[model samples]
Target: MKTRIQELRKQHKLSQEELALAVGVTRQTITSLEVEKYTASLVLAYKIAKYFDLTIEDVFDFSELEEI
Candidate 1:
């Protein structure tokens, strides 16, 4: 899955560790998400979206999954 996480982080001037800390995950998990190496669980996804003050759909792209 492609994500705008890196873009958002840059715009917000947040490091991976900062974002991870805010969202209650490891920096590695944030890196994995940015690199599309991991798909977040529902709880994690919600936490991430909430941290950015966005809805799940705003933070995550479900279009690709829909195509399948």
Candidate 2:
């Protein structure tokens, strides 16, 4: 999955560690999300999006994925 985590984080002037702290995850987890090496679960995605004051679709690009 592709995410706008880095972009949003920069726009918010937040470091990966800060974002992780705000969202209750590890810095490595945030790094993994930024690199698309990890796909977030529904709850995690919700938490991240909410932390950014954005919808999940705003943070994550799901248009390329086929419907399950």
Residue-level lDDT of model 1, residues 1-38, one tens digit each, is 87788988999999999999998889999999999999
Any runs in candidate 2 off by more than 4 Å, and if so which?
Answer: none
RMSD of 2: 1.2
CA RMSD of all predictions: 0.8, 1.2
Worst 10 residues of 1 by lDDT: 1-10
Worst 10 residues of 2 by lDDT: 59-68
- The candidate scoring highest on lDDT is 2
* Alpha-carbon deviation at 16 in model 2, angstroms: 0.4
- Return model 1's CA RMSD, one decimal: 0.8
- What C-alpha lDDT do the candidate models reach, one value each? 0.91, 0.95
